[model samples]
Target: MNFNGPLETSALRQVEICDSKLTDQLRLNAIERSRMMDSPNEEVFDRLAFLAAKFLQVPLTIVSIVGDKKQFFKAAHGLPSPYDVSREIPIEDSICRYTLQNEPIIADDATKHELLKHHPTIGPWGIGAFIAIPMLTHDGQVLGAFCAVDTKAKPWTEDDILMLKELTASVMREIHLREKISELEDESQLRDKFVAAISHDLRNPLNVAKMGAQLLSDMDGDEEERADISRVICENVDRADKMIQDLLTASRLKAGDKMPLEVTFGDLSALLHSTVESLQKGHRRAFHFESEKTIDGHWDFDRVRRVVENFSGNAVKYGDESKPIRISVEDHPESARISVHNYGPSIPSDEIDNLFNLFKRAQSARDSKHLGWGVGLTVARSLAEEMGGRIEVESTEEKGTIFSLHLPKVKPSLH
Candidate 1:
């Protein structure tokens, strides 16, 4: 049952071979990866195994690490159980071990290989031809073996082996990426929990402060003192309310349980005008509204309004408050587009793909003083998609950034 290291070759022969051909490091690394897969959240590993099986069009695919006494299945796609065999067979009987020792991939005709001619599992399971490729990490450690098994003795083409190897490489990369994402999700959840606990504890004191400020203002005293105390309480209350709203929005968006949309025909011009006027009150930024060709569409008025407000608020907070924020409405026969442009540093190319993910914000936005919980665009995107519309963002260093919302136009009924 002991699977010893690769057989010792002559010193001169070993010295002549390239370092990349060495199998000792790869085998040990695969053992380490197999142990890591024993932890919770191994679904990512399992998914990769399944993809490998599908890509190779094989009935069985396994991510296995061969130990001294057993071959452990870290991830198995076709097999029903995680541990298939009770103990490891002889090293000469291990196809994967031989595959790793002799190049990256190995395939043998079951009928031809003397070592596998009498294998119990191969004959009993009707397995004829098999292939195994080493799964290597970026550091040149073999994490495990990516293997595919078939029941028929069909000859495998060179292309088949090449494709399987490519798939194994992709699976290795995916496993590494999934690990990183899991770490980030854990960190984000911890931060969210801390914020929630702090907000909950502050709520009681905030309510008490509001009540006390109201009572003091009602008492006969200097008018200036009463006004100032009332203003202080109001400002604090508004800040608390904003924080609560942001948290609620993030939660609802994540849960996918926000209010149902009630779509109706609406004039974009009037909506933009009213939204701008309301957002401008008490705000120092100048607002410029423009329309090209009368813009009209059938949309959820309230939801669309919320999207507009979110964009405007973001512009006011991130863009220069001294300059004007421009809102443009463009109408076409089939669709109407609303764009909010703000002057600010351009967003990074990498973050654009993930900008709509829950709680994901661009790096440029992270340091902004007026930042929210990073849920505005996420919610806006979900709402827009539900209403059969699309949202896009474009940014440039010189021209600044623009967020565009496009919705379908309402057509007259033929009936």
Candidate 2:
């Protein structure tokens, strides 16, 4: 959305038309990659747009992504339509076009500004003052601008531009994060297909390794050394097989494949405690599991166990070893709540939203002594959602980090 505001300046009176810039084509190309054309308002963008309007104390504000000839409003505040209705305007009528080509702009009186004076929006839209900051991509593409508008002439302070620039930066980061996630999801889908194809080819080789190890165990030999070697070989084979299976499942989930869960009625409490006990045997720290009684649920027992391992493993690896990792299973009327809480540094607010993003880790996690690819939560969340439930996360300096998951207690019967 294009905007005009009460804040005016003499700086843009004789400014060159935005079209005079040769980089318009490259800028348009990058804007196209954002996929914002004719898109509806997003909450993230809307918040910043409103913040820009209120902070500038202007009558209008907009977050626009400019394309070849269209200005698409990802969000807007105080904008009345056909501009709002269409959520786009011709680039010719968009003052934001200049902000893309050059530096951020200000026009104290649009009626006297050279290139903008005779523009189509001035008289009808009542453009008296305007200001904008460029929305830049990481690779240095100017996508568009976060702009404010007024219908009456006024002067704006340097602080106004600074605040708007900050808001634009915030909005651009969100936009870039969104684009990154989308790109990763698409890449994951392609990778999943490739994994599925290769998994089939590798299955026979894995079977041979397992069978060979088993044969060695059965053959006549010095029992002690032979048995130990056999056991090591079998263990490694099993581990490799499990890795393949996990990769197959993750790929399928990322590719939006439905899980063929072998659901059964079972006790979630028993499952959690048993898994923790097994892990505690090998893990360096203590695990405290709390459950008053059995909480029965119809779930994929294997999948639930996997989720527990992922959460518990992360806690053991990253959490303070001196503190016990806490896991609790509680029953809700229609669901079972399973939570894993670990004592550690709080996850930053900026990184929380990306916590479950595929192949992404909290910056703190990356900076810590622990290492991970950050796909566990994404997989866990998908499994929870597939089972007609959801996962939630909370972190605080005092309380540490907790991953809470609720799953439906009843599974719908399938034919």
Candidate 3:
């Protein structure tokens, strides 16, 4: 997934590209890592812009990060009314984007300059003279621009351009420092979450198994009761073991490792029908199956079964029990889709993307009377991608929730 930066603006296609770097994903990632776009103006950056304006004698100066949709003003000194208040403008209207070519833009008279003359905001904003210095990281990815603008046409001397360049370096220093700090904080939070999730989620099943064993040892029940307790103990032990395996898998996948898969020919339709039948025996919720007679594919059987069970388990836990949970398999030319759908409260739009993240549970899941470690979806996504597939989800009040896995018919590569 791409980083949708904070600016709520239009698409990057609106901007005329003079440099391919303007659309480079790595460059955009650097900008996102900086975390400077749409952020509150810091005194340190405001001071730099102020000093640039005063030293260069330009009425307006800005420190901006040019994003795909819009240009965000980290600092705007002496900027006009609405733009200063909003701190951003559509990418099509931004003259600062020209600096992404890794060169300083010096337009003495923008109205006559071939490149600046056609931009709509150039005339209305009374930008007669402007100089933009590209803010480049140490690795030479241009983030955006540090520019000085004047209402009246004027020539920039060498000394003035040199000073502005120095200040641009200062801007990049601050951005890089902030990026490092954010990375460190994220690492710390990841460690904390790992500790918390293991300690909390693993305790429930372990305690259940321990209690069942203790009850059996006490010999307070008859033979039938002892057998029941033994079965419960085994089930709880299996549950705990599965949780540990999922935790390890999620951790490895999160660290950018591909999961190992055992590929074999199988019938997806048969897989779903059998899995759903077994689930129906265990769960009170009604299970309905629909599919062609057979949907053949080369894929990992155990991983696919794991995903089916997870999706169906979620449906049983959260869906309205009165309504039947539907499981279906559809065969396409290049791929096959297995969907598990249930009627229940819909997932909120804001929380949908987060559902696949480690330890991220939907609001409905948190509010429901069900217990989950929230690692299932994360591991499911990794397994699907490793098998050259993806998971798609849709939820609405009228349509209910649907979780579908799209798998390639033929294996993409050896695991």
The candidate scoring highest on lDDT is 3
- Give all candidates' CA lDDT scores: 0.66, 0.75, 0.83
Q: What would the per-residue lDDT of candidate 2 be over residues 1-415, giving only the tens digit for each residue? A: 2334322454343234455542456566677778876776778888888888888888899988877667788899988967778888877677677765547877777677655665667798888888878888887778888888889878888888889889988987787888999888886874665455455545655776677677785788678977666655665565455456656667787687876678899888888888888767546478888997988879887778777777877787777778999999888888888899999788887688788876667888788865455566778777777677788888898998888888889995442
Error of 2 at 409 (Å): 1.1
Q: Model 1: how large is the Cα RMSD against the reference?
A: 12.5
Give lDDT tens digits, candidate 1, residues 27-101.
554545434544443777688777777776878887766543345566677774323433233433455544343
Segments of candidate 3 deviating more than 4 angstroms: 1-60, 64-73, 76-106, 111-128, 132-145, 150-152, 155-180, 183-187, 190-194, 220-222, 281-284, 369-372
| TM-score of each model, in listed order | 0.55, 0.52, 0.71
Model 3, position 10, has a per-residue lDDT of: 27
| Tens digit per residue, CA lDDT, model 3, 133-245 | 99998787788999999999998899999999999999998888888898778767756776776787679879998999888888874989998888778767766787787
Q: Where in model 1 is the C-alpha error above 4 Å? A: 1-216, 219-246, 411-415
TM-score of 2: 0.52
What RMSD value applies to candidate 3? 7.7
Q: Number of clashes in model 3? A: 0
lDDT-based ranking, best first?
Answer: 3, 2, 1
- The top-ranked prediction according to TM-score is 3
